[model samples]
Target: MYNIGIDLGGTNIAVGIVTKEGKVLKKTSVPARAERPFDQIFADMASCIRQLFAETGIKESEIESIGIGTPGCIDTEKGILIFAGNFKYGKNIDYRAEMAKHFDIPVYIGNDANVAALAEVRAGAAKGVKNAIMITLGTGVGGGIIIDGKIFEGAYSAAGELGHIVLISNGEQCSCGRKGCWEAYASVTALVRQTKAAMLANPDSIMNKTPLEQVSGRTAFDAAKKGDKAALAVVDQYQEYITEGLADMINIFSPEVIVVGGGISKEGDYLLNPVREKIKSRVFGIGLLPDRKILPAELGNDAGIIGAAMLHA
Candidate 1:
């Protein structure tokens, strides 16, 4: 039987018809226009699902279940979106019941990052692995932890917040209102900040050619590739910050693999090789335990849909 997956984002609601093995048979999306009421958003979701079925000529009976990967803290058992700052609508919205208004099918909900991690473990970078951690380095750092082939949602269904761990006391400020959080140091936002700072301090650097407003996560990495000394220093420091958090995660979970996703992972080995080398010494008993592999996420944008579809598994 097929499963339907919904990737509900602030900007778009993406729906997909997926096979048991995580392949997307058909997919489509609708604008979320999140400022609207929750009811209207869900109606659009149902409409999109129906449209997919019409386009694919698939019947409702062929669908085994429907799953949604949404932003914010999710009450999976209750199907509630506890809080999502990006949405104008207030918290505690019942998502499962809302979708159920359209279809009589078992629906599951999971945090977007968690589902993405599930996608990696089941079909992407960590495929065939029973235990893994996926870290997404985007505007902020997002984490998904899987143990024994299942998502490890802790009490209150809010575990896997790896980025909030403090990397330094009284250090840089973070969006989570914490000082010195790992995300404040290692996220792509932080990388851009560091790049701008280095460019300002070293006017001769290759990155300074770009206007400060145009500086982005790729600015430093791109300059470093050309052997720019200041840019290289910025990249080295950024990688160290990333390694610090990764080492801590390794010491804590010791998962078989760590899958790096999101925008930065696009750099591939250029971004991971140095972190891998640096992590060797930081992890405890590095030689005694089998080496943990770090890999880029393979599913890319499809991970959200594929992972949401597998929530029942």
Candidate 2:
């Protein structure tokens, strides 16, 4: 039977029909218009699902379940979204009840990062592994942990927030209201901030040519590739920040694989290689155990949908 996966984001609500093996058969999306009431957003999601059903000529009875991957805190046991930073009015939303109003199929919900990790373990980079960790370095860092091939939500279904772990005390402030969070140093947003600061310090740097407002996650990496000293410094420091957290994770969990996702991971080996090399010295008992693999995520954007669909698996 087919499963429905919904990737609910600030800008869009993407829905897909996925097979048991995690392949998306058909997908469609609608603008989330997050400023509106939660009921309106739910209505749009239901309407989109109906449209998918009509376009694919699939009977409702053929669907096994509907799962959602959403941002912010999720109470999966009750299918409630506790809080979402992007939405204007999403608080303690009973998502399962909302979906129940439209479809009788079983409903499941998970934190977006958690589901992405699940997708990787089920069909992407860590497909064959039973233990893995996924880190998404976007506006903020997002993390997911898998143990024994299942998502570990901890006691409150709020575990695996690896980004909030502090790497430096009283250093850079984080959006999460913490000081020196790993996200404050290792996220793509952090990279942009670092690039801007570097350009400001080195007026003659190649990166200075771009307006500060235009500085992005790639600014430093691009300039560094061109052999710009200031840019290289920024990239080097950012890589070290990433490695510090990775080493901590390795020492704590010792997972078989750590999958890197999000915009910055697109840098591929340029990013992974340095982090992997540096992580070697930081992990505990480094040479005594088999080397852990740090790999870029393979599924890209599809990871959220495929992972959400596999919630039933």
Worst 10 residues of 1 by lDDT: 81-90
lDDT of 1 by residue, 1-313 (tens): 9999999887888999999999999999988898998899888988888999999999999999899998888798988989986667569998878888999988999999999999999989999999899999999999999999999999878999988999999899999898999999999999999999999899999999989999989999999999999999999999999999999988999999999999889999999999999999989997898779989999998888999999987
Q: Residue 178 CA error for candidate 2 (Å)?
A: 1.1
Could you tell me how far off, in angstroms, the CA of residue 49 lies in candidate 1 after the best superposition? Answer: 0.7
Model 2 per-residue lDDT tens digits across residues 1-313: 8999899888888999998888998999989888998888888889988998999998789999999999988789988999887666469999988888888999999999999999999999999899899999999999999999999999778999999999999989999899999999999989998999999999999999889999999989999999999999999999999999989888888899999999889899998898888888888997898889999999898888899998987
Candidate 2 achieves a global lDDT of 0.91
Candidate 2 residues lying further than 4 Å off, grouped into runs, are: none
TM-score of each: 0.98, 0.97
Clashing residue pairs, candidate 2?
Answer: none
* Candidate 1 accuracy as TM-score: 0.98
